[model samples]
Target chain A: MTELTEIKKQDLLYQGKAKEMYTTNDPDILWVHYMDQVTALNGKKKVQMKDKGKTNCAISARLFTELREQGIVSHFIEQLSPTDQLVQKVQIIPLETVVRNYASGSFVKRYQTEYLQKFDQPVIEFFYKSDELDDPFLNDDDALALGAATREQMAQIRQLALKANQHLRQIFAKMNVLLVDFKLEFGLTAAGDVILADELSPDNCRLVDLDTKQSLDKDVFRKGLGEMVPVYEEILQRLLKEGER
Target chain B: MTELTEIKKQDLLYQGKAKEMYTTNDPDILWVHYMDQVTALNGKKKVQMKDKGKTNCAISARLFTELREQGIVSHFIEQLSPTDQLVQKVQIIPLETVVRNYASGSFVKRYQTEYLQKFDQPVIEFFYKSDELDDPFLNDDDALALGAATREQMAQIRQLALKANQHLRQIFAKMNVLLVDFKLEFGLTAAGDVILADELSPDNCRLVDLDTKQSLDKDVFRKGLGEMVPVYEEILQRLLKEGER
Candidate 1:
């Protein structure tokens, strides 16, 4: 607590659509300020919702802490405030690692098939995170040939992503939430180890009510199904209740 | 020759942008009539070129024959005419197998990168061949989940495509032509064996002069750079000359 009060934010390092990154007193640490902004379709559709950032921070902190306890390494250090956190400084690999338990969203759209298609196994995909090209879907070979990621890094990323999906699927199932699919980002540490670096929240995940098929994640905001912040809060509260139990 | 004369082009079975298929006397054999039509960007740009179909037939027949000599199985049976061929009847898998030695065309456009970026190793990609969705790029898992291809089928397709790539790369290099990339299709025989299928020609391959980097394949018609029929004829002539040696 003393070090937290003494350390000061130095300079803005980077600003993304939904979060701002800043340098901190410790060179190995960074400060992430999650904004109230929610973006869909790569920020083409966006809105600022009250307490959205706080909800995301709570969910991400709890999930990352749980993941660490489960032996998955991540960059999350500590929650500094309701909507801010301190994290390890790492170079982000410019790829969006997506894992899917069901065919939805871009999957259904790309295949031009009926929605809510179930799969016997989960699917993992990667997209180059460039807004200019609209984040085109990339295969393993494309990732290597384009120099976006090495074969070793991609293998590790896929392994970690599937593990995260399995853990999240179990956690959400306890709350009667179906974890449909989610996106993850990884970064290379100074030691060249790839670690999960992005916040895991409704904003980066697709969750639905197991019974009603109603949206419980960012799809609620993307589809205008209902107010999103309350749903995110609901998710956080459900997890907290499960923790207590 | 006797069977070719006796078996007339029967009922039209299928009609694609560049070719037409007809049932034959034997259920195991089908007749393919390649048309003079040329299409690019999924048929958004199209034109009918004189003798284009004939040129493609010559190249595909010769290549398939050579591949057969190299112990690779394919659907090609025999050439019936300049623009028509008899092929084994098999169910065509709806995935386009694309192999690349250099980044060009849609690859450059999708990644928004400079063209002609070389790769140390060839890159293999798959696209679900649906005109409705504009033939979206598909990962191996996406193919399985969407029922486009099985894991086993995908594995076999990749092996065959890379093998074909190696053979073609060597053949073209002999003529001082660099084989940039090419698209392939596979089909399942009645015996449940996946075999190489579909025509291979300048229309489906990217070729450039090794020394001058001059476009020698479909890019001529795709980019409206110049006449394509002459270039296709040139490719066929070069391959024929190599056969003589």
Candidate 2:
């Protein structure tokens, strides 16, 4: 077991799967250790998905760079190493924000209607906490009833999610891939300014080849399609090769 | 094809499959036609799960009655008929809010983690519009970036979501059913007050027999476990039977 000692030496705060988060003396600065360990199924089933940590760090760093180039603010300051990231430590808002541009996953399972036929309009959803219960889809009333967010804040979140989705979609389109969907996190400063938090990596998104429909994200493991890590590496190699050109 | 026809004498708004919403000229009250059209997978794959809509209505009515009895504020005014609901018309919010108490669905898929472990803390999530992209989980920054909510409002939503979860969990525990997870929605009144909105039906929740592990919600369809509607009916019957005792 990778104890918290190594992280504590650097003033660790929280230890989440794949990353040991540390708070620097400066409240705004954070150091995250992209550990070698990999977790699946919410840490219930831990498998040493070899090199996953390094791969995620590299991919995330690259994606963050791309996002920044496109004017999307993210926490990624720089790649400290293949397995570390230096970031801004904002107070993370406890919400997993998602935006979608295509039809897939629970949406397919929920409505099972034709509404998903290349829906030009984006839709938003909110899920309250209790990961052990698994995150369930919620509506606005439920949100208010549960006090997960206020009506006004939810409106703001929706706009932000939509903007992020649009920006990422444009970037991926240029790369000949469709940014199907992605997860984002946000944090607040003590002063109450919300900033984009969390890592933007292949692990948190779904990327499909425009021509062949090949996935370049962690959906392979999720769907049990097989050999996902290699597929991810291949996608990175392809991106690198294209960059060289 | 359910087409909307205005009964010239009566004003009505044919809202989606689940409800036919209408209002009296007075505008203080609202009538909803709780239809029997139970759609799964957005109506792409239809299963004639008989008595599903009625069961959901009954289940929702019964659950709301219990919630009211417990002094939980909810939108349910009264059950007009087996398939219709009478409610107070308020400004509706177009967001789906979800809260989970146990692990299930995409959480299992995305995290590829355990099914039903208790979390040290509840984890709230948000998704932007469009289920076709399958409700993508989101964070606060994404929420704000999309402009769906404000900073203070998001905080309030979190508190509300947590409170609702606690209330529901307590109620279900007394009923000897585990409130595994459920969806909720909220709306604001003309006076800028947030109130619980929507029907709390079996369709929107996952309930299981405390002893037998028989599912009481719509997870059957999502998981393709088979005969989901009947399973829902069975659960209702069980609840009814318990009430008789």
Candidate 3:
């Protein structure tokens, strides 16, 4: 492993909807810049919201650090700037893992289930991470058939996701927020071990205020409830305030 | 457990797209008459073909008998006539279990994968069997949340489904037919045991001629290849000839 005190960012590798990845001098690391972008409906609806990137970056770093303290491994290395970070580079497994504690979003749309209905167990779903296919929802068998992830890798992801959910639910509950559901992505290490990857923030989480029941996450933007960034900043402030305690 | 020599068919219980169920004098038996009808695209396309009913009933009876001989329990009791049968009455679990050996039909439509692409292992999927909802695809967690089936029952269904696949594949292979994919419906017996139910014929399976690669099952109707009943009769003849051998 290169232990250079100063890592130089190199050519742009990939530009995603919300983040841009740049190669670093270190082969095992990449520099990520979170763009001030928000998208829904597979990038059909997009917006550039000021301070969105910085808010997400801070929340992601804080959550990753908290998870690391609780013995959950992630790709997060360190925050470089308000909108930038350095992370371990790995081949991302193309599966969008969603863990839902309460019925909402497509869960309600698909089965006509009652919104916010509590489930006995957290419902975990896998969606093929393909924009071309509109990110169709699939299952473990479909994921395996698509060669997205091995059976063992999926099992490992489920375990990690459940653990992260438990920790995250507690973290948000302490902030007087209801963690309804969240999405996570995983990558395979060079050693072929599965670890959590991707940014964690209100951007990918469905959160509701414990008392007011107002959506505190991306749904505010998705449903056109109000300005989304203010709600995000509110979550970050609570997180930082809880840190002081 | 009623052993009536003559089970009198009473009144119509349910009318499906391709069959009608009548309550029998015996509480544990259902009189089913396969109708001379075929539906595609979830009943938006409908047609009535001569000999379709008798052909499906015969094929379903033969296949169920073969499965029973292999120690696989199903609800089929006996064939009453060319188009009617007495089935052990079971509460149909509202799940359409699909097992795929090769990609075709909706699998191709969803993933845009090549048709007839073979899979390393059979991919099993579940859909909530609601006509009103258009039978949306779901997972084990979704099923559990909806109270569709228990973890143990799903495991059991998977096991039994795989076993049935093994036998059915060989039977089809011997007939010089390729077993592509099929849908199976399971039901719960009064004692709470899950067992295979529903008709098994060209109506619910995707089969192709081994040499010609022409679809011999419902795809003939779904894709509008030609008259479908003759192709179904071809399958019936092949199955019967294999039995004679």
lDDT of 2 by residue, A1-245 (tens): 22223322257798887789988655567788777665556667565677778888887787777667766677787777787887877866556776666656655555453422354466555555446656555555445544556667667667767877887777677678888777777777666666677877777787888898877787777767787778768667765665565
lDDT of 3 by residue, A1-245 (tens): 77645888999999999999999999999999999999988899999999999999999999999999999999999988899999999899999999999999999999999989999999999999999999899888889999999999999999999999999999999999999999999998899989889989998999999899999999998999999999999999999998899
Scored against the true structure, residue A199 in model 2 reaches a CA lDDT of 79
Q: Choose the strongest candidate by DockQ.
A: 3
In order, what lDDT does every prediction score? Answer: 0.90, 0.67, 0.94
Superior candidate under DockQ, 2 versus 3: 3
TM for candidate 1 is 0.94
Kindly report which residue stretches of model 2 are placed more than 4 angstroms away from their true locations once superposed: A1-9, A37-40, A113-116, A144-147, A150-152, A241-245, B1-245
**Candidate 2 CAPRI level:** incorrect
Candidate 3 chain B has its poorest 10 consecutive residues by lDDT at B1-10
What is the alpha-carbon lDDT of model 3 when measured against the actual structure? 0.94
**Candidate 2's TM-score:** 0.52
Which of 1 and 3 is the better model by TM-score? 3
User: What is the per-residue lDDT of model 3 for residues B1-245, given as tens digits with 9 covering 90 to 100?
Assistant: 56756799999999999999999889889999999999998999999999999999999999999999999999999988899999989998888999999999888889999999999999999999999889999999999999998999899999999999999999999999999999999999999999999999999999999999999999899989999999999999999999998
TM-score of each: 0.94, 0.52, 0.98
Candidate 3 is scored at a TM of: 0.98
Which 10-residue window of candidate 1 chain A scores lowest in summed lDDT? Answer: A1-10
